[model samples]
Each structure stands twice: as structure tokens, then as C-alpha cells.
Target: MSARNPGTKLDLQWVSKVRVNTQAVLKRAQQIQGLKTPKKQWQAAWLLKAVTCIDLTTLAGDDTPSNVHRLCLKAVQPIRCDLLKSMDMHNKGVTTAAVCVYPARVPDAVKSLKAANSSLPVASVATGFPAGQTPLETRLQEVRLAVSDGAAEIDIVINRTLAITGQWEALYDEICQFRQACGDAHMKTILAIGELGTFTNVYKASLVAMMAGSDFIKTSTGKETVNATYPVAIVMVRAIRDYYLSTDTSTESLLWLALIKEELGDDWLHPHLFRLEILSSDSLQIYHGTSLSYVSH
Candidate 1:
């Protein structure tokens, strides 16, 4: 999104000093969930914003070039042209934030995007996605390969074992290697908060990822048993804000727009600094519903 986070040396002191008041975090999350959502045109506008920040993803095992091509085309035109015309947003160049797929599917996504004459980015998941159990050298090479295949963004998973076992330095070192492997491509670090044990460890991992140069710190891999929960997201965004205040370097947030608005304010809600990874079908469904509501009213 913004400039790449150059990253800082491992601040063991800061990482160690972090703590989470579980009950307080739970209370804040409940309050946010109880808040009211936008209605009518305002609801449509929010949906539009979400569409632009979506990373349309297809990580299925049966993924093929044809389906990847289809995914790219949908990303290029996420909403119906007629509905956009009704909203007078047809010329706004609205589209999904990016299209994400596995490394083997990067080339397919790149080729399809080019054929469509669209500049949408192709993001690839590397570093033993869903599980960071791979050897160090192998994970690094996986990142390099994805970049070589034209992945504009690389989503790498952190080794949960390191975070759980209090290996902050090791976690930071591994992420730094991934940053180098990314070269010019943006790096989005997945904390996989689900397996990171407690809220405290999740906050620690988020800080370590930012300190190690993650342009964007993400919540889950969509494969985890607990993906992107409100409580976990609250911890991660706080880490993002804390990192910015200390380093003056902004890290993007992938939590919900409403949550970002409440936690980090409106500035962080833009697509450049915020993203939502969603399935193509789910995004399309939401888009369809929002557009119909806007057109009917």
C-alpha cells in the first residue's frame, strides 16, 4: 500500500513487554459488533469500498488456468456495468484490490490479467502456506520463485512455533529473509493468529512482523480453524498503530473496514492501507445484493 516498511532490528524489550487484557479486548469487540451498519446509499458506498479492497482469492487444489482467467476477468469488473451506471460510478474504474492464488497459479493469473489488459496485481501465497513447517532455505526459495513468476504481492506465513515458544528474534529473522526475497514486490505477513496460543502472543507476533518489514500484517490464512476473529483482529490493529507511532512507518491492515474505522480511524480504511481476502463467489454475491438495493431505491 504505502511505502514498503524497511523494518527495524528486533526489539526484544518491546516484544517482551507487550500484554493483552483479554476481558477488556472482548468487551471492546462486543461493543463494535453491537454498533449499527450503514443503510441505503450509504450501505452501497461501503460495499463499493470493500470491493476495491478485496483480494479475490482462489486457493483450491483443483485450480486451473481457465478458472484463474475467469477470476481475473471478474476482478477487473467486480460489479455489474448497469448498476454502476445507475450509481454514476461506471467511469470510476472500480475493481478488486488484487487476485491471489498459489505459487503454481501465479503465472496463470499474470497471463490472464495481461490478456484482459488490466493492471490488477497478482498475489501469491508462499513460505509453506497454511503451515510454515518448511525448512528455511526452501521457504526463501519459494518466495523468490513466486516473485520471479510475476507475483506483485507475496503473502508469507510465519512459523507459529517460534511465536508460541517465545522465539521472537528467530521469527523476525525469518521474516526479514522473506522481505529480501520479495525484492520490489510487497510482502504481507500472515500471523496465523489462530495457532499463536494467546492474545498476548498474537500481539507480539504482529509487532515482530512489522519490525521485520512486513508491508501488511494479515490475520489468518483462511485455512485456520479460527480465521479473523474480532478479538484477534483488535490485537493486530493495535500493534499496527503502535508500530506507526514508534517508527513513523505505516503498516496496512486487513481487518474489516468497520473495525479499522473504529480502531485506526478513517485514514486506514483506504484500499492502499486496508485489504480483505475473500472468495470470488462470496464477493460477487455481496456485490450483486448491494447493486440491486442501490438500483431499486
Candidate 2:
């Protein structure tokens, strides 16, 4: 929701020179792994913070207006009223950051949010989501249509073929096209890191996504065999920090708030700059004082 990235031109030299030390990345991640979760009051506070940053989502082949409408309702009041009241947060306008759905379901989300009188943005996943193998023209049009349908945000999945094949220029050009097609809608580029195959590839892809005007470079589609693991996220946030220092444009941090606080500092913790894309409702079952592992998905 900040200003657009206004991406730089393709700098093959910067992309080519990057090298990630896999062993080093793994060790750093291990340090985070060994840490303990916060105590009750702090845990409650962090969970509430996480609630405000959630991108309440439903991206299923069976998705319909009915389901999307329900999703919007939940986004408006994500937690039980009593729980929030107990925390004295009932007066706060605590809703998820946005409601994400497939492109065709954008209007459904728009209508539902309007009926609820909530101003939360509707985000759509476009550009042949999950597996972005569609033709370039088709993918670009998907983004345009989503924006026209009242989606304030667009989550796009980059073509793995482009990243894996080392087509940095092509990848940059493609994301640039997505950025252009997005118009005023903020763009969150999904790198689909699990399929990219290496920490080095993930780092390079993150840099290229930022360089190509991605407002946020995300970890996975949540449909991958592996989605949002700690090591991959460590590499991605480090890339975001690197991009910020070099270009003065900051892409949002990775999944873990603690990790964001540690690597990017407190500035990146704000909701406008960072987001947590929660595709499943089960992840929000924390009103019962559940373990933190529930959201580790």
C-alpha cells in the first residue's frame, strides 16, 4: 500500500554476481529454529498483530460466490469478539489486510466487502497461478482483468521455467509486464521458491522480482510440495534487505514476523509494508491458546 517500487532496469551484472552460501543460510535458520515462542501475554499480542496482517484467502478450484462471500465475512471479523474484548482490542478495527481469491472471484469479494461496509482490499491471484505456464499475453491480460474487477491487490506467480532456466532478463521483463498491467493495484510477486531448487536461485529471483517493481516478493503459492520453509525464507528476507539498501525500495518481508524484526528491523513490521497470506481458516484457531505450530504451515 506504500508507493510503487518504480523498478530499475534489468541489471544483469547485479543478478549475476549474487551467490548464496547454503551452509551459512542453513546455520542462521537453525538459530531461529532453536528459539522459544513468546510467553502468554506477548504471544497473545503477537497473534493479534499477526491477525491484523493476514491476507484471509480461499483459492480453490471449487471456489464460488458463496464461499468467497463467507471468506469476506471472516476477513472483516477474523477473531471471536469475546477474545478481542478480553484483550481490550475489541474497539480496534482489527481485520485481515485483504481477502485474496482467484481472478474471476474478485467481483464476489468486492460485493461482499461492500455489503459488510468494510474497506479491506480484495486481492486476486492471477497470471496462471500455482503454475504460471500460460502464454505471456494471457498472463498479462489476467492481471489487467483482475484490476478492472475492483481488486486493489494482485498476487502473481512467476514462471518457474524462467527462474530455473536462468532467464533473468526474461523474468524481469515478464514481472515488469505484470507490474504495468497492475496499474494502481499493488503487486505481490510469488517466487514459488520450492521449485526454484537452490538458495542461490531463490536469492537471485528475489532480487530480480524487486528490481522489476514487485511491491512484495512472496515465498510460495502455498500449493507447492514445500511452502515457506525457514531456510528459504531466511534467504528471501536477506535478499529483500539487500535490495532495500541498494535501491532504496523495500519489498515486504517473509512469513515470520520475528525474522522480519531481526533482519529488516522494526520498520518492516508495520502492516502496510508486510503481509501474512493465510489461505486456510484453520490457521486462525488460536483463540484457544494453541501452540504456535498451527500457523507454521
Candidate 3:
């Protein structure tokens, strides 16, 4: 994977001017979802593409090492061998983009993947994940610990209080520190849009994260009452486009846009640039035409 340069110097004036028109965002999202659906082989191809970009996740309080091990196995071979054979994808090096887990479980995930001889990167949620209410020093330490424990990627949640209170500069500085702590590990900054309470705030927070050099700007930690939504995703992706245009760098942006393939093309769907967190097996089944046998950890 190519390295994404960390964003330098927060553009406060530009951030302050960011706005989201609810009606326009909603309309565009609806239109994108209504694009012509790919059928038969095309549908299967797109679903397989979707599977490759998924961050097969298991974020639960009751998670155990055994379950995490099984999750890693599933990540190595997401679809059953029979299904892959039937689709002629059995030996195509198909695998989920990464395995996400809590900071404490990073070692377990790494051990499991190593035992399986799979090199899938383990992504650990850190820095008071899902809430991020802890002190800055503690959060930075959490990031460093996860990286030390064999995590190749650190998913750090931003302080929503900073965004809600319009403390853009403080949020940018804090995230930059967290990025530094990550060292060589990729940093995925989770904005937790559900808690941000407005699309505009989500846009601003997305900009702040990218400016601070987040390798990926994730929509949620999957802990909030509302996780990922279309309107919120639209706002975030637009912010990503804006940042890309302004800097002309190869930064990545992720969204679940299976139907809007024409507009996004194959390049935008790469795991390095975009990721779709599969929240449910049912959604996977709907796309793949077979029941996902593996249970969520």
C-alpha cells in the first residue's frame, strides 16, 4: 500500500465555510442508490468487489480470543470454498481488506493470522475507542500500544465534543498527535457522524481528520445508535473530494456505493482508498446469493 501523506496546516477559513445542504445531499444519495442495478455476472462481480473492500469487524464487549481467531479465519476465506469454486474465484487471492478489533485483542488477532499463514493487516480500535473522552496523552499512548502489539492500522475515534463545540483547531492538533503516535501504522480517524448531530458538522470533522493526515476517515465506530448513513456518507465523500482537489495528493476516501459504480469506476473502489464496513451477514447474503456461514465474533 502506498503511504498517504499526513495533512499539514488546518485550513480553518475553509473549514468554517463548509456547509451541507440537506435537501441536495439527500437527493443525490437517493439518485446514486437508484442507479441501474448490475445483474447476473455483473452483480456477482460487484458483490465480490464489495467483499474485498469490507473491514470484517467484531467489536463487542464479550469478544474472546477464540472468537477473534475464528473471525481471522473467516477474513482469510470470507466466502466458503464451495461458493468461491462455483464463482470461479477459488484461487484468486480473495480476502477481506482487514480485520478490526479492540486494542486489547490485537495480539490475539495477530497470533491467529500468523498461525493461519495469512498476512491480512490487523486494525485495532484505540484511544478510548467509540467515545474518545480520555485525556490526550492517554489516547496517544493507546495508539502507540496498539501499534506495538502488532496492529498495522489504528482506528482512533475523534473527540466529538471538539467538533460539536466548533473547536476545529483543538481537534486538528489532537488528531495530528494521535497520527504521530501511530508512527508507521495507518491511522483511520472515526468521526462517529451519528453523534455529531448534523451533516455540516460531519463535513467539517471529515476535513479536520484529513487535514491532520488520517489515512482513512471512517464514518463511525459502529457503537452509536446510528452508524453509517447515506446522507452523512455523501457529505464526508464530498469533503474528501474537496481535500483531494486542493492538495492533489493520493489520499483515499471510502463509501458503500455498489450501485453507483459508473460514477466511481473501479479505481475508487480499491481497499487502499475506500472501505465498506459490513455490519450484517444478511446484507452480505443479499449481495452474494449465498448465506454467510461464519458468525460475527
Candidate 4:
């Protein structure tokens, strides 16, 4: 696994066609066996980690993000600390995953695990998440505070009006400011695709975000109709694949220069760790939400 093994070549001849039929790509993934298991979870993790350049977090309900933040860390702690202990113990540089929080709970989320030595990535949403209508200034302030609170990742929504009206310039500037506010924090721009009302808009907005400097172009806040669908995700992933192809991979390039840092410790993500925060049953709930039956330890 040398970094310079001339990485696998990605053919981009069908980027648009792939984007057009991303639903099919997801269908192909679903056909794979045991996609719900820990071993299979790596696919989803890998997409976010490598291609989309983000750390995935699950936001299930209206529960305050701060509480969910603790809940998330605890949910996967077993799988992370115990399961991946071997890999992480060998190298402390890696981390657990994502904190996945609501905007209001970021401060406490950062404070909650300050003493731990693991990389418990803190993420928050602004720009009027869920509804996405707060003033831009407020969103910036939220970004400022979230960063100040030790948030490693920031997920923000696009302004629905500007998006529909095609105010991409304004939209781009907003994100640029957010990128500035985030400073070194990775930014995952959530399109809330369901609200975009069309796959076309979703595709376009995703491009706009990525072109403007979004570390990751995410599908949704997981609270709306289009939340985290395999189809929409593929669309963005496809677009990114296209964007990446035409662009140079030089070290000085914007896309090349920025790399998303792993915020989850190996043990912090799975099992066989010194402490336990997450359990299998609770994690089943994270992947399955209310659709499945799961019990917490």
C-alpha cells in the first residue's frame, strides 16, 4: 500500500451518464451481501472518507445535537474501541469517526470528551439547517462558534431561494466565507436534496459547492425526503469523479491541497478499546433509524 503505487485509474468517460443513473449504481450496491455489517460499513465510510472527502454522521431525529453527539460517540464506541483496537493501537494517529451534532449542541459536544486522547470529530450544521433560512451572517456566526467549540467538521445547507433563483455567485461567496470561518475545519456542504425538488438542481448545487471549496458534497441532513439516499449520494460522487478528472491532481491545486483528516480513532470507531461509548444494538438504530428494532446496552 505504498502511497505512490500509481493509484487505480478511474475512467470518467461516462461521468454524466453515471450521474444520470446514480440510482442504478446504488441498486448495484444494495445487491452486495451484508452491507449492514461492520465489515461492510467500511464501504460507506470509505466513500465519505476518500471520494467525497467527508466523515459521515447520522442525524436521526429532533434530539438536540449535543445529546446526539454523546450518543453517537457512545453508539460506535464498542465497535470502534473493541473491534478496531488492533489497527489503532498500532498507530494512534487515526481516529474514531464523526460526532454528528445539531448546531446548538456543538459547544457541549466539544467539552464532553476533552480528556480523551482519541480523535472524536465534532460536526455541526448551520445556514438554517432542516429549513435552511437564517440570515447569512447568522450562519457565519454559527460557523465561527462551531469552530471555536472544537468542531472538526462543519455541514451547512444552501439557501433555497438563491439556489432556485440561480444565484450561484452569492451562494459561492457564502461558502467561501464559511471556508474561511472554518479555517482548518473540514466543511461538508449539505444540499438537502429532497428540498431541491429535482435531481438536476441537486447535481448543479453539488457542483457549485465542490467548485467553491466544499471538502465534501453531502446528500442531506438526514431529516428530509432526500436524506442520505444511495441514489443522490451517487449523483454527487459521480459529479465529484467528473470534476476530479478534468482538474489536475497537483499538490498546489485546491482539490489536491485540501485533505480531510480522519477524526475517529480506530478503537473509537469499533471495539477492543480502553473505554466503551457505543454498543451494537444502538448502532443498529443509527444505520436503521426507526425502521428497525434495536436495544441499547
* The best candidate in terms of lDDT: 1
Poorest lDDT segment (10 consecutive residues) of candidate 4: 284-293
Tens-digit lDDT string for candidate 1 (61-178): 9999999999999999999999999999999999998999999999999999999899899999999997989999999999999999999999999999999999999899999999
How does each model score on lDDT? 0.82, 0.81, 0.78, 0.51
For model 1, what is the error of residue 33's alpha carbon versus the real structure, in angstroms, after optimal superposition? 0.4
Model 1 clashing residue pairs (backbone): none
TM-scores of the candidates are 0.92, 0.92, 0.90, 0.62
Off by over 4 Å in 2: 248-255, 281-297
lDDT of 3 by residue, 1-297 (tens): 446555769999999998789999999878766667667987788788878887788888888999999999999999989988999999998999889898999999999999999989999999898799988889999999999999998888999999999999999999999989999898888898889989999989988888898878888776777777766767876776677668764331122555324434445566666677764332221110000111121
lDDT minimum window of 10 residues, candidate 3: 285-294
Question: What is the Cα root-mean-square deviation between model 1 and the actual structure?
Answer: 6.6
Q: Give the root-mean-square deviation of each candidate in angstroms.
A: 6.6, 6.2, 6.6, 11.4
User: What are the runs in model 3 whose C-alpha is more than 4 Å off?
Assistant: 250-255, 259-264, 279-297
* Pairs of colliding residues, candidate 2: none
lDDT of 4 at 26: 57
Comparing 2 with 3 on TM-score, the higher-scoring candidate is 2
- Residue 91, model 2: Cα distance from true site in angstroms: 0.7
Residue-level lDDT of model 4, residues 108-214, one tens digit each, is 66666564544567778766776778878888898888888778767778777766776766777777777788877767677777787666567667666766667
What tens digits encode model 2's per-residue C-alpha lDDT throughout 8-113?
A: 7888999899899999999988877766767799888888888787888998889999999999999999999999999999999899888999999999999999
